[model samples]
Target: MRVVIAKCSVDYAGRLNAHLPLATRLLMLKGDGSVLIHSDGGSYKPLNWMSPPCSVSDVEVEQDQADAGITEIWKVVHHKTADMLVINIHEIFSDASHELGVDPGLIKDGVEAHLQKLLAEHIETLGEGYQLVRREYFTAIGPVDILARDENGGHVAVELKRRGDIDGVEQLTRYLELMNRDPLLAPVQGVFAAQEIKPQARTLAEDRGIRCVVLDYDALRGMADHNALF
Candidate 1:
């Protein structure tokens, strides 16, 4: 089995559904951390059908069969071989940051630094030796923003959104659901960090025992800067 990773501009699930043939099986890993697998009936044609099928002028029936076989094989190979695969929007671009007119590496660096600072500050508040789990991939869900172990022996999952959009809460709820199912993550508390949160959403989170923190750009920047100085 061979694994191939392709960069796709569209959503991974949509791309796979369009490209994968009916006979091939497909497994989709979503950015919001959802997993789905599809199985198609096996093909009727055999391999090595590339030769001319009898008296055809400029058209080979064998070639058509071979093409179909190859296409199905490619899909099967891609699905079976990959243990875990991510199809993030960021991976679509050759120079993603540059495509967005920003330095990709710098942006990543800044985000990592900011995350580290946020983790440190919050861990201290929770008490000592809290470690940050970076790029932790969850089953069904791809990667969460941050996963941390609190000093008091609790798990913490944080999601960061730039805007104060209520729609974003749906994704966080999915993450929380996954965490609740995992034995290792059951002790986890979910936190939503965004610039602003809708009043209804805040109320909903509070009712559900989730923590929502709203921080403006300047406030977040100040926290990062403060963490750096200390």
Candidate 2:
């Protein structure tokens, strides 16, 4: 990964047009060929970012651009979408690179771990014909909580959370993206399961064609009646 602190202006073309005026910002050139531009604030989110499967190259600056204090230009073009992110650099304050080895991935808490086990034992909770493939099914990115197959033999990836949020939805989406790339799991579906799901999380999950399932912890544990009204 390479990090650069520079005074630059940004322009994005394709799908939409956006411009960021000249300012001092942090530019990240990731190992996966993604580029991100970030300001001093906004927490973890970059002000603008281009995801992986893209190429970045140094491009020549126009005479007028050079006259306006631009020293260099970096062009990022998406491989699939053809979206382009242009960075006009006036000055680079700092530039550095780091070699980050393979990530171990996030560890789930005790409750989530237990929930995964319960769901695996009762995979049919997802649907009548669902059968568990395995728990913690490993992928290049991370492990999905549960991998199952529907009645029609379609692959399904389940992401479990104690309280479902947008982040959880996004995580599952990444897992699904990677899993579906494999010929074996070309059509893997996603199930976001939690004890309680937030409205925003449900909306996003459904929008992405991922199913949302609310788990009854006690019932799954066989401690509560399934037919109880209260």
User: What residue pairs clash in candidate 2, if any at all?
Assistant: none
Clashing pairs in 1: 33-140, 33-141, 33-142, 49-62
Whole-model lDDT for model 2 versus the true structure?
0.86
What is the Cα-based TM-score of model 2? 0.65
Model 2 residue runs over 4 Å out of place are: 114-159, 164-193, 197-213, 221-230
For candidate 1, lDDT tens digit of each residue in 116-146? 3565455443336766765344434334677
Clashes of each: 4, 0
Q: Candidate 2: worst 10 consecutive residues by lDDT?
A: 221-230
Predicted candidate 2 versus true structure: per-residue lDDT over 163-191, tens digit per residue: 99999998898788656655567699999
Give the best candidate by lDDT.
2
